[model samples]
Target: MRVHQLVVNFNATAQKLVNWKMIRFGFVLVVMFTLVCTVKSYTFQIPVEHDKNGEAYVTFDGTKHWLKDNKNLEYMDAQNCTVHLELFALPTEESNAYVSGWRLCPQEFDKIP
Candidate 1:
């Protein structure tokens, strides 16, 4: 009878150990998944290119989430404008000084469609 009781106790102990290990493994998997998702969401790339007239421009890439438009056109006579990252850093000007080809545009051009 004593030998049978010992065998039952050992089985119960082994089951508890297995459950504990499974819980720990599940927690680790959740943490790893969270880390990967956060990293992917935070960072994005901008696409930059130059035209035949040597004008640099920054455009968005829809396929790769988002891409950076990093083109240093400070010296060049390009109409490329910086897409502001912060809300307060955006240009306050009503119209761009370097822009052209819109001389005859209607006064209510900014009205929403």
Candidate 2:
């Protein structure tokens, strides 16, 4: 009788552990799904012009010309004053989907001179 009671208790403990693990896994999956569903996408254009030194000057389509957040500027070479085109999209806000900003690099601009 004593041996039988021990076996039954052990089985009940194991079952509870398995149930808790399943609940934890289900919770993780639900959180991941929610995150995947809420992202936004956007596009912007950046205009570039050649300065007197032949370096690229970045310009935006609207009134903004300079970068709003320093964190958004990636792959920048301050010494060379150059950056990748996609850096312009770094400041964008993502809500329901992945939002992207448009950037016009120097190659896309026409020579003013």
Candidate 3:
């Protein structure tokens, strides 16, 4: 009788552990799905031109974002290609922010020639 009682308690503890693991796994999946759905990213090509002071910048929606990185300016001149601006927004952010410096679109680089 004592052995039966011990087995029952052990089974209950094992079931509780399995339930807790499942709850944790479910929470993780929910967070991942929420992030995948809420996170947004976009990329577009825009011409880079130097201002009167010889600083390179790109204009988007009437806003001039200066390129402060020397490497980006060099790459733009070397490739003679328009800059690819990557923009992304976090789940908590209301407005999108630039992903910094110039490069091919990470998510759609293969689609561009």
* Most lDDT-accurate candidate: 3
Task: Report the lDDT tens digits of candidate 1 across residue range 1-113.
Answer: 99999999999999999999999999999999987775454344343334465343334323211112432222211233222221111132322212111111132234526
Encode model 2's per-residue lDDT on 1-113: one tens digit a residue.
99999999999999999999999999999998865553221234444444454433354333233433333543433343234333333223332222234332443234534
Q: Model 3 TM-score?
A: 0.41
- Model 2 RMSD, rounded to 1 decimal: 15.8
RMSD of each: 16.2, 15.8, 12.3
Q: Each model's TM-score? A: 0.37, 0.39, 0.41
Per-residue CA lDDT of model 3 for 12-55, tens digit only, reads: 99999999999999999999997665433333356565557665
Winner on TM-score (1 vs 2): 2
What root-mean-square deviation over C-alphas does model 1 reach? 16.2
- How many collisions per candidate? 4, 14, 0
lDDT to native, each model: 0.42, 0.48, 0.56
Give the TM-score comparing model 2 with the true structure, all chains together. Answer: 0.39
Candidate 1 Cα errors over 4 Å, as ranges: 43-113
Off by over 4 Å in 2: 40-71, 74-113
Stretches of model 3 off by over 4 angstroms after superposition: 41-56, 69-113
